[model samples]
Target: MANFEEYKNIWVYTEQRGGRLMPVALELLGEGYRLSRERGEGAKVCAVLVGSEIGYLAEELYAYGADMVYQMDHPLLKNYTTDGYTKVMTDAIKAYKPEIVLFGATHIGRDLAPRIAARLDTGLTADCTRLDINTGNYMKYLTDYTTASSSGLEANDGNKGLKQTRPAFGGNLMATIVTPNTRPQMATVRPGVMEKRERETGASGQLVKVKVELCQSDIQVEVLDVVKEAKELVSLTDADIICSGGRGLGNAEGFELIRRFADKVGGVVGASRAAVDSGWIDQSHQVGQTGTTVKPKIYFACGISGAIQHLAGMQTSDIIVAINKDPEAPMMQLADYAICGDLKKVIPELIQQWDEEEQQ
Candidate 1:
């Protein structure tokens, strides 16, 4: 095994598009700071930026707790392509060694991280919900053990690796993974799972500019133009409050009550997989293992059964209110506030109360 001491610093892939930083990048940088802080001054939190004319984002990274920013700026690299990004990022990692690299579990990140990992011959944990540094928990298990039968491995520093924890087995359970033998521990974290750190006033990080050797031949794909998506699209991850309905809603028309309640509460409508499959609502509003993950300030589970898959998506909400007639349902049990009653009657009653309160 190579000397782990040679690998230094924690790096976050600061993903951007059209010169705008993604929210997940800042979220990961905040987590990187937390992981590096306990390791003392030697382990620095660095942001690996790859885009054209995005050098100005260095200060933003610094403000969010990045100690250093590595900017690989080029006109050809403005738009993200799997071939172009993976090549430059893999090259950068080889030049500047990082013990752990964090990437957001976004569309681009999902495509890029795996390729980079394969090129470098490293393991990657994808869509991780949590990340932390090891702190002597595994040392006790290895204390009585000696040499490995296969690789003849011995414990040097058991508490010094990055702890990558993620949902596994169709989101039924969570598994924690550690790459003790790998040079750079890599993981793709889900967006909205980690909280963003507050920016510091007048704080700045060290900027390191990197130049990549590239040509038109190197990029297999070319960007002719960029088409922007609708600005008013419903994003559960970005919403403050989400009112979700499941099979408990009874039928497609059940969603009408949910929509009314959601509108009254100033929240967006979300759907369970059952609701979506039954054609009650669009898949865009589905929340589960196969659906979008969300961590809203408040979540209302209207007729939503708390399946492990569904819980995995929205359990992180700060406040969960479950409305179901069955008190024994998992959703009701996990909720901060559980209303054991018929939603048909309860929903209208609540709306009526809201109307009265508004009149007062």
Candidate 2:
């Protein structure tokens, strides 16, 4: 068994793009800080940044509660390559031996995390929506015998293990997976699921520079150029207010009204999976389990039945407004405000009233 006592601190993979840090990375640092406080008094929160000329970004990590920042900077590490990044990350993990590692479940993280887990021969929990230090009866299920022989958590208490929870069974159920025997319990959390802590007034952390042995031969693929996609579609994840349509809109034409409502509120348009599948809207506007998870400030659900899959995505929104003729619909019951009327009629009236108030 690996030595559990040797592992220390919670590490967050601080991902960056075009020299700027991704919001999800900072969000993970916030969560790591919270997890450190919850786990005990002495455990530190660390940020592992891998890129070219990103030494200056370490300050942002410290401000977001990172007690330490691990810098793996090199020209070869500028852009993300599965093989090159995986090699350096694996080497770092072997050397530092962190107790927990958090990655944002972005395209990069999803690809890199599994590779690291495979190299270390450890378990990885993906798309985690919740993370906490395990406690109570849940700890009973986590016994030394349940852990793999290669796991480093054999001598540790179950309470100290990271609890990684995600929606499973097609979003019908929630499951919490743990790596009790593993030295570094790894998880990839969805963006916006965790809140970023307030920046510290003048906090800073220790910066550790890691030099990895890498060469051109190690990279199997070559990048010719990076093409950026046009921003024609609405970004529901970053939208403060969202006006989403469902099957209730009846057809693709129904979205015309949803668009108007969204425009009136200065919000973006979202759609239920049913709407996207029905060809009423594009899949980019889909909001639910199979689509993007959003935590907007205000979410307006018009004509949606509020399936469990859909609710799993937007339930975290600060405020939910359900507009459905069916008073007993799940969204209606769960919404902060429910309007038991046809959205076709109600939406126009709402817009008209807002316009009138604005004119006055």
Candidate 3:
């Protein structure tokens, strides 16, 4: 069930939002750059971008590491409807026929990767933390957290070694997984999971503009209108600093303390899953493994306990400050600084201090 000759270069599904590129796209490109070079390949990193008249993005993708950009620009592709994207992406994969496909585990990526994998009839590993080529075993490994396995690679006289490492058991440890079976091996990676490489100064590549043939009857979803919601809910994902509350906050009043502190610091409000589940705060503000993954410059995890899932999202932040009465809480262990005391009193003091500092 395995054929080494059928494999080819690694590929990436470069995603665009409102005609603008998401940060995750660049991150994936950076990784592809590393993987391709290690295999003595010419960074054969290819990008498949499909949208209505959006081929203009190919140049930018090349600058970021795309050796070749396959673009399908069309009017029907303007909006991100599942049907149109799936069809176009499926076509791109069929035509180029890459050995591996990488999708960013972002808002759109999470939705798109699996469908493409299903269409290709290949095994897809979602949220992979790392990828590597093994020369000793000639296997490709996809691993996350402490979970690992091998691709059961074929013997290669022109190779190095393979060792894929990733977080396993909810960020507790790392395990490496190898595909011993499938071709065009696939993996979806989370944003901020990997380091970004230096950009190529004036890096240029080949670009192809292809128009896919389609009929009006082929389109099933009708776009009546685009009702854009103007009301912006406070989201921690985009916040610079988040003052989050959790079960340790005591009750509604404690959460209110967080809101006040957040306001004073000019940061958005946030909460742990415990606070959100208890209805003490709106679900939008939750930050944890099961909630929004945030990498704020500074995070004030007030009264929240740090579970692995919660840390999984926010652990990538520049700095973490946790507050809780229980010194032994998990949050305290992960924080850059921990304060033990009642948040009700501590938060008010912080707000006052912030105000005084601002006035000065």
Candidate 4:
């Protein structure tokens, strides 16, 4: 019953809003490039842009490594509501079949990827941190009859596994999965996790524009008015510097000190999970397995206990500075520079020094 006769290439769901491409689109393009190369075969990394007059953005995808661009320019697709996007994308997938599909783990992606996979009856590995090809499993998906047998993606070749890796077990471990039996092995990768390819001017790829079927009844939500978030979007991902404090601060008032230090340094204030879970700070300020992953130019850990969950999020920061009274603390050991002094004293002095330098 599956249309095994159709489809080729890898697909990254190009989510466009306000005429700008999100960073996750670029990240997937980077990974797709490497995965295509590993196969030692030419596989088009396609960008599926579904919306109104979004064809102009298709060429930009090619600069980021897309070999082909599929555009579904429709009037009903002007704005994104779950129902509308899923409809158009599903239609496109049924038209031009792809091997692997990637989506950003942001709000829209988290909402869309699973639904699309369910409708197509395909296996999807969500929130992947890494991706690679495995030839050993290519034949396995074909012979291995399971949930993956439903999607019409089969090559009469040997096994080539697509490995997707992500952090698991509360960030205590990492897990790698292979889609040995599914067509368009889908995944939702975290934002800011992968590097974006360099965009080039005048780079072009093949374009296929398709008209999709749509009805007003298909749209579930009606647009009232659009609202924008506050001017400062709290870009923890792009933060140049961060100041984090944890349970060592011990109480709510302690964060005032941390906030002051952060304010002086023109940095965002971050907190360990313990501090956040204990209700000392806001959820957005928490850093760790359940928090935002950051790679700031400088990250300061103050009065914090370094649990692996907390470290998992900020470990990848460019430079880590820590101040813990207990010199033997795990965070202190991992810090690029560790201070074994009381934060109550250290913080004030540092602020004073920065002030003096500013005045001079």
Candidate 5:
């Protein structure tokens, strides 16, 4: 068994691409900072920065709440290779043990985190929506968020275990997992779920440079060139306003109206899982538990019933406007502004009013 006592501080795999830090990395730092503060044992929030010539990004990580940064700079790591990154990260984890490690559930993070965990013989919880270090906070989360009865659960106030909560059974249930035996408890968090702290303009932190030992023989696949796809992809996470459609639209053609309304409001088009599964829209436009989780400033739900699974994804939006004929629908009940009218008629009227207001 590993000596859990030796591991200290929290580490975030600060993922970056093309010299730009990913938003998820900043968000994780925010969470790590909070966890470290709650743990209250001089546990610092640290960031692990890997890639060639990326040491310059360390300052930004510090401003975002990282107390320290582990810089791993290497030419072999300039472009991400599974073998190169995994080897360096595994080596670093073994050398400088951390109590907790976090990764964003992006494509690279999903691929990298599991490999490092396997190498270190540690446990990793993937796609976690929530994390807690304090026992009280964990218990409160279970009581408030999950449907499972917390009555039967035992509480241990002294347990400082990382409570990693993730959606299971197709977003129908939430499971909180812990790795008490592991030294560095690891988890991959989905983007847009956690809140990011405001950046401090000139904050500073300690920087540790990691030594990299890698050769060509370690990597089997060679990336010859990266081809950029020339197509417009919907960026739901970055959108301030989102106009979404659901099964109540009745047919795929209903999305046409949704698109028009979205265009009018300068918002992006979003769709519920039902609409996407029914071939009403592309999977890229899906916003829900089985899809992308979003927290837009304004979320307009048109013809949606608002199932729990759907609510899990967009309930965090700043303001919700539900347009459904059924007044008793869950969306209408949850929405800040519920309109009990046919969306077909309501949408046009809303547009006309918006246009008239603009004309003035």
Candidate 6:
């Protein structure tokens, strides 16, 4: 068994592409900072930055709550390779021994986190929506967010281990997992799930340059070139307003109206899983637990009944406007503004009013 006591700080994998830090990396740092404060033994929030010539990105990590940064720069690591990144990340974990390790649950993160966990013989909880270091906070989260009953829930005030909570069994249940035996408890959090702390301009931190030991023999596949896809997709995470359609739209053609409304409001188009599964829209537009988690400023759910799975993704939006015929629908209850009517008629009227207001 590993000595859990030797672990010190919390480590976040600050993932970047094209020399730009992913928003999820900043989100994790904010969470790591909170966890460090909760752990309360001089536990710092550190960022692990890996790539070639990316040493300059460390300062931004510091500005966003990273107390220290581990820079692993190498030519071979410019593009993400499972073998190259996994080896360096695993080596770093073994050397530094962090108490907690976090990764964003993006395509690359999902691929990379599991490999490092397997290599280190540690446990990793993937797609975690909530993370807590305090037992009371964990239980409170379960009470507020999950359907779990308090009848059997026992609270241990002394437990400071990371408690990772995620949706389970096709979104029907939530499970809280803990790795008490592991030195560094690891988890991959979905994007837009955690809130980012405000950046402190000119903030500085301790920087550690990690020596990269890699060769061609370690990697099986060589990335000759990266071709960006020409398809245009809306960035739902960055959108301030989102106009989404669901199965109640009745047909794929319903998305056309959703698109028009989205265009009018300068918002992006989003869809419930039902609409995407029914071929109403591309999977890229899907917004839900199994899809992308979003927290837009305004989320308009048109013709959606608001199932729990759908709510899990967008419930955190700043304001929700639900339009459905059923006043008793779950979305109506949760919505800040609930409109009971046919979305076909309601949306067009809303568009007309918005246009009239603009004209005046």
Task: Give the top-scoring candidate (TM-score).
Answer: 6
What is candidate 6's TM-score against the reference? 0.91
| Per-residue lDDT over 225-263 for candidate 5, one digit per residue giving the tens place of the 0 to 100 score | 877676457889999999999999999999999999999
lDDT of 4: 0.81
Model 6: per-residue lDDT, tens digit, 48-127? Answer: 99999999999899999999999999998999999999999999999999999999999999999999999988999999
Misplaced by over 4 Å in model 2 are 134-158, 233-235, 325-328, 357-360
TM-score of 5: 0.90
RMSD of each: 5.1, 5.4, 4.5, 6.5, 2.5, 2.3
* Candidate with more favorable, higher lDDT: 4 or 5: 5
Q: lDDT tens digits, residues 183-208, model 3?
A: 56778887666656677767888786
lDDT of 4 by residue, 1-360 (tens): 344335456888878876788888888888777677765557778888888878889878999988888888888888877888888888878777787889988888989999999988887887777676754443353346223342454443344557787778776466668766657688998887888788887888889887788888998899877787565346677788999989989898999998899899999988888898889988788777778878899999998878988887888788999998999998999999999989999989988899999999
Model 2 lDDT tens row, 216-308: 899998977777777567788899999999999999999999999999989999999999999989888999887889989999999999998
Score residue 168 of candidate 4 by CA lDDT. Answer: 80
lDDT of 6 at 358: 93
If scored against the real structure, what TM-score would every candidate get? 0.88, 0.88, 0.80, 0.83, 0.90, 0.91
Please tell me which model should have the higher lDDT, number 1 or number 5: 5
Enumerate residue pairs that collide in model 2: none
Query: Residue 179 in candidate 2 has what lDDT?
Result: 90
Query: What tens-digit string does per-residue lDDT give for candidate 1 at 223-313?
Result: 8888985654677888899989999988989999988988898888998888899998888888877788998899999998888888888
